[model samples]
Target: MRTQSHLRIGDQPWVKWSLITLALTLVFLLLLVPLIAIFVQAFSGGVSSYWQNLTDRYTLHAIGLTLFVAALTVPINLVFGVFLAWLVTRFEFPGRKLLITLIDIPFAVSPVVAGLLYLLLYGANGWIGSRLMDQDVQLMFAWPGILMVTVFVTCPFVARELIPLMQQQGREEEEAGVTLGASGWQLFRRVTLPNIQWALLYGVVLTNARAVGEFGAVSVVSGNIRGETNTLPLHVELLYQDYNTVGAFTSASLLAGIALLTLFVKSFVEWRQARQRAALSEDEA
Candidate 1:
């Protein structure tokens, strides 16, 4: 069973340390160092000042808005992601591969491009927006636009995670459930859901993280109309522009903390998925 890599890359421990140190240096300097620098700048104001900046109502509202967008976006993407995963995996239809590939349009498409798509579709002169304008409806410059595009950008997260997982699990268990007179809902809730729960959840977590952190396109579409349209990322930019570095950094720290919390959550999800995959193999055997 023992395969390769028992020997050092060059059969030298010292060389290995040098390589490791170099790799760490590259990672730390490029990524970690800058991140730490932001924290250093943020906290340089001391705890009391940072706390006050964090407690500011405007900053709090921005955080709330970010959470609100994530709240709406994550679930929508969760539903869409799972449905698309199931659709592609469970059935064949016209243009199936094309549609599945289109799901990833968000990845190839810039967030800015996604926003612009919405903007063009919903803007006063744009197709949908022009039609909706007869009713005086606004989507491009409001929370609706923000949420939809976030969902669009992150929609593939869950489905992409689940498809491979569901594919690997194969359809036999679900088919078995169906064969045993289980209803569609019952089979899904009992058999299908349980099997893919971890992958689904992992996707949701990733979706949430990206939703909370989204900018660029959200910026273009949101109109940044002060308290009404501002999200945390936009709010940070606003503060930075206005020379409120302390407040901006305070907000940045909150986002940073959220990112860290998500990492742990995502790690646990991966662990759960791994465990489930193992259990599934045992059951099949």
Candidate 2:
């Protein structure tokens, strides 16, 4: 029995260390190595070349457009996400499940398919496109189209994050606030928003990351017009096609930097959430 117990204890550490080592190796190979390679390639031609690559007229414009699209996409989705979460979780309604499934359609569809769908709907010869074209409106190959696709792709992030949380929280506190004569907006602001703010922020972070990193859908609509419609991802492809390897990697590095920053923010949010849950558990105990 003593020998068996000792063997079991020894086996436990071996298994634990083996798993830990495997996880670290995968992380280093899949994430850290690629990240390090990007920076190394970006700086291969020296700091001046790296700076010039980033500051090139087309590259700068691509970066600016990427930021612009993310700015518009994140806020619109945030508003829509909050309202959708509130509606679905706070009230019982017909077609609520259908509405949720529709919200998730973007996730189910490929980004390329999403771009194609928009093109068919808003292309020059498309259904509404013909009517809009009479007014000289260009939607398919313009910034508006890019913004639309980004919003479409990212709309579900915040809602997904909040729905489960709001459901678990229930409407009891909201009911209490309402009974106290709090207005609908006041109840949301004073009670609901406070409870869900962290989750909302987490969702927004995710939405922003997807919006900025989005390539396929944006690529199809953007028409790849350099210095105008090209986003950072598209610009990276353009540079590579033009045989500017260092430039391509430099552009890619900027994107990787944004991703790293998002990951950091996500980690922070998760840490805060864990702390909040611990506190709540202690209070209940």
Candidate 3:
């Protein structure tokens, strides 16, 4: 008996190799080259100069303020993301779709627009500015404004991550827990938390990255006060504007390192998620 031969679609070797070469070239030029350039320029002035630039008082302050903003923003967004995901996924209500759409508005809106909106609302001539001024509360061009815009821009990260995962999980386990007389807090702590923890963490990592790296919106609201409102990105811009190329690149190296570290963590999370899914499949099999 003669066996039928298999035919492969898109089996042109030349086409495959050409596409691979193109992709590699683009990645090298667009990503790897810029990354290496940052380090090369940063150390062009030698270790001492690089160290001095990094340890300058203003640079230290900028780093500290960036960390502070990330610390404050991540937790708030994490809680809000989880709560919003749970609310929308586990309940049916009027305007539920609209609420979810609104939550996503930030993602659709430009970061610059997000900052400008806050400025319009809180600037001295803005609607509530006079009221806040009467109370001696500072918003625009202050830490509060920076914090507010950071929160607004990063709001969608966790919620976007959790919403689909929670929806796919459905309410079966939760319902079972409730039927077993578990309190709301008990159900969440025991039944729900474990299921969503990985996704929650993934979201937190993303939120932290964006919070620290955010430039556009924060720049608009921060007033770019050196050693004060100057986040790391803003600090880099200030350094570059002052013709301190080495200083700017040095400051930028820190952010690049952060981006690299975040990429590493994200890869690990994705690997673990894949492993978890494979293990579940094996058990079912």
Per-residue lDDT for 173-249 in model 3, tens only?
A: 99999999999999999988888878888899999999999999999999988888899999999999999999999
Show model 1 residue runs off by greater than 4 Å: 1-9
Residue-level lDDT tens digits of model 2 in 1-285: 456556654377778899889999999999899999999999999999999998999999999999999999999999999999999998889999999889898899999999998998899889998899999999988899999999999999999999988997889989999999999889989999988988999999999999999998998899988888999999999999999999999999999999999999999998887787687678768
Q: Against the true structure, what is each candidate's TM-score?
A: 0.93, 0.94, 0.95
Instruction: Candidate 2: list runs displaced more than 4 Å.
Output: 1-19
Highest lDDT scorer = 2
Clashes by residue pair, model 1: none
**True-structure lDDT of candidate 2:** 0.93
The Cα error of candidate 1 at residue 282, in Å, is 3.0
What is the number of backbone collisions in each predicted candidate, taken in the order shown? 0, 0, 0
Candidate lDDT values, in order:
0.88, 0.93, 0.91
> Where is model 1 poorest over a 10-residue stretch in terms of lDDT?
1-10
Question: Which residues of candidate 3, in runs, are more than 4 Å off?
Answer: 1-9, 281-285
**Residue 22 deviation, candidate 1, in Å?**
0.9
Model 3 pairs in collision:
none
lDDT tens digits by residue: candidate 1, 1-285? 434556646557688889889999999999898778778878888999999988788887788889999998887888888899999998889999998898888889989988988899889999889999999888888898888888888888999998898878788888899889999899989998988889999999999999999998899899988778899999988999999998888888888889989999999988988888788789879
